[model samples]
Target: MITLNNKKPVNIYDPAYDKLFENLQGNILKGHGRNFTSHIFLRFEENKKDKVKKWIASFANEITSCKKQIKENLAFKRDRTSGDTFIGFYISALGYSFLENFNSSEKETDFFGSMKDANISDIKPSDWESGFREDIHAMILVADDNLMLLREKEISIRKEMNGKCKIVKIENGNVIRNEDGAGVEHFGYADGISQPLFFSDEIQELETKYKDVKINFSSFFPLSQVLVEDPFLKNEEAFGSYLVFRKLEQDVDGFKAKEEKIASIVGRKTDDEKEEIGAIIVGRFEDGTPHILSHEEGIIDNLSNNFLHKNSSNGKCLFLNHIQATNQRDEASREMIMARRGIPYGIFPGEGREVGLLFMSFQSDIKKQFEATQIQANHYKDLIIGQNLPQKMNLDCFGKKGKEINVENFVKLRGGEYFFAPSIPYLKNV
Candidate 1:
């Protein structure tokens, strides 16, 4: 039994690890797909660079010891929708102090300095502004079984490392922690629903559109903009996408109060039944399933219900729904859909502002998937957006059903930026 820092040995042969070990010839097995739970956000103290690296190395070592187990679990499928056992880790940009100086509207800043020389002919007009501010470093984990077990392992790894890493916050279920209950950012509307899917054909098509241009796929592989000889080689590379990890602190009590008021205005039966009210407003449940499809045709599966007979005329989700607002519901028309591969982070703080999603997604187009979501948020109740389009200026987010519900500044952009998650080979070798 291999172990690291006294942690229990993970079993690769266990049914939970099939996906990871699926192609390992005859020697190994894989894991199953399970819910990713027990998120911990560790913020390192400024000037503790060495300590941070050491802690990360030790934690990585512990995870590496379980490679054999990871390879043998049947639950390791890349796109497992059910209870799959999996573990993931990726360093984010949050540990840096330079990120604090970025202004949301600033055209120039230290963080986005690298992007200035970039030839961005391939990017859409709407996405030009989002290419700034590389803040909020992050790591991700997914597992098949209990969240507590995962949390326990994380704590052990951190403790054994003995570094300056402090538990800045923790949470579960889409940025909202257990403590805050129903109040959080990207909570009820099925956050990360309208992400962009990767297609090689699109890459080639993109090349034709912009000769000698590099298109950055956040969570996928092939980090460079240069096209490879064989496109399939790109597939052989990483998933060919990028992941966005965000740590947003939610205004819990405030959100709950607002939601209650919205429900009452919508004539909801009770406050506890706000999920239903939310579903009506967003057209989808909290778990990424469409309430309209769920009750309309008895479609209960979350994933299937999300895509089946989705309404795209005015957007698959409601105008107020976060995902719809983000993507503008142009998915069905353009065959665009982004897969969200992230979860909530931080334990809901009963008092202070500390809770939100670890928030990551694999998308081909950040603007189509990520930026779209932000625009939708602003459309709903973004203070920044509201401030820009004040009521005195005849600004409004809702129409008929929405006019009754006063959405006053709920979502806020703490900070973020575009990042490139290289493939395994690029990550290790390049």
Candidate 2:
């Protein structure tokens, strides 16, 4: 827990791989806040298991002899492992407190507000199943055997300890390809499709280069729905970005049943066609095209996401999809985008609450990206999840997916929180 440059020590709780987890914890203490940098990714290799154990001992020893009579605390743990890859993360109370103060803005440039809008206070880390905690949006993925050993060599071991375990990391497009899952979550409906563009110095330079181009408010101030301006840093201070980690209790079986029922009612045809049902209701196909245009013309294109279609009779895609609903494709103005990094969590046991996905997101503005979806889910029943108004929704299509959805008893929002994910540098200093 030593300070570096007067900065707080970052507690790394990733346990995707057990060995990596123990290694990270030990290294944090031995390195004394020197090794674990913020916003940077780390990878632990299997061959380096011994190296990781030594590092864990170093941190455990420090905690054992801590002079302050350290108070015992409860933390979240996620136990996901591949043969070679395991994924997990953790958050300290100090980090959790930062999440509590995160405020959402009413709109971009609307800096002043009398009171906070949403009440995510009731949301609790306790709501998570067992081994999970709120974490920053970006993740560290490692498959390199050498870097894994290199990580171990960096650890400074002081003593030996137990609680040592090993885990593996799973490799998927989520980490490498920007668009993973063909536009859906692991449970399926394309996600991260619509994200708020950050108003970084680099973005500003781009604005300058394109004179005729207009960076919409949403682009500059992504997640306007939940952008909270820090009073201390009011106008110029770099605004804190909020991350909401939710361990929602989802009824996957129930969800699947409803999806099937909707499909039958919509007169869906092939299995592939059934798969497309989710996309239809969501508006954008997995490949990111409007179903109306994609199926009708039998065409698919990722770039089609950028092609703005008029919201008229000839509109290529329906407006209900996650991408279109919040992106403000043909609206009077553009809305902010919050990058959603959510996954389904829960097990499919006989009765108890199953767990999966450590749902997460990063937003300069939360109100637009996050809140807009909430509004749609509550009002329209998140058409993607087969949740929508019984008959009021305009689900007029050939497929049963969007055509005849009950709209009632669809996706439910259990609980959630607002967190701030700081940069690597910020983590070291904070």
Of the candidates shown, which would achieve the greatest lDDT relative to the real structure? 1
The sequence of per-residue lDDT tens digits that candidate 2 reaches over residues 1-430 is 1111212222323222222222222111111111111111122233454554344334333321111111111111133211221222222222233322343242224321111235322234445323333232222221212335324422321112122322211211222112442433434444454443332442454456555544332233322333333322323222234555444444556656765765677666577667666665566555556564565312653333444545335534354454445444544324434555454433232466553344555544455555555555445345433233355554464322343344444344443344443222222222
lDDT of each: 0.39, 0.37
lDDT tens digits by residue: candidate 1, 110-218: 1222222222221322332232232234343534356677667666655653556555444455244223242333444444433331223333544555454333222
Task: List runs of model 2 lying over 4 Å from the truth.
Answer: 1-184, 197-239, 249-256, 296-298, 315-320, 330-333, 343-356, 384-395, 398-405, 408-414, 422-430
Q: Global lDDT for candidate 1?
A: 0.39
Worst 10 residues of 1 by lDDT: 23-32
lDDT of 2 at 320: 48
Residue 12 in model 1: shift from native, Å?
18
